[model samples]
Target: MVEHGKGHPDRLAQGEQAITEVAADRLDEDGRHEGRLVLTPDRIYFLDNEHSSGGHDDVIDHTRFQGAEVTGDDTVGTLALNWSDQGKVYEGNTLELRTFKDAIDDQLNP
Candidate 1:
């Protein structure tokens, strides 16, 4: 079987297991932007769809993560993630908040 999405999961980690993938977003100075969220056993990847004019990728280590949660209703909400890097706290999330949280929780617990 073949999988399809905005980005390629294979580009993440070679020979590593992929837990899940979803269309998501990341927090930036401008605002929330569309991105491809890929989950592995030990890391979370938020990569921008290269086809887009301005796209980038964020590789977050689970150990550096401080916390994560979903807020607001399905109508209008945000997926929030907190992490510490270089002594600074960083935030990352997607507009599909609930869906993002569920995927992360399932992988964390399963």
Candidate 2:
């Protein structure tokens, strides 16, 4: 996972660039799979892998996440980032404090 100070510029660029082999995976219960894609001023992270884990792996590679459409709630903020290639959608929630802990676990075992 990629961690940076709040409002890091690299994190912001991730939302705008075309990243390849961006780590993608799915949770057991259809929840989101959150992790970092790259480390730098511009990083791209993903929250959910529901679609990619299914039969859309190639679709995700073809599409590039450009921006997010946010839907906020009390506990979390959901985002649907638009992809450039296959019109695929990358769905995820805004990063939270606990997210870092989960990412650490994955790194140790992954």
| Residue-level lDDT tens digits of model 1 in 20-90 | 66666555675666666666778777767644432366766777766666665535555566667322112
lDDT of 1: 0.58
Candidate 2 regions exceeding 4 Å error are 1-39, 47-65, 86-110
Candidate 1 residues lying further than 4 Å off, grouped into runs, are 1-7, 51-55, 85-96
- What tens-digit string does per-residue lDDT give for candidate 2 at 1-110? 23443322332333543222233232334454543232222333442334333232222221243443445455444434345632223323435323432443343335
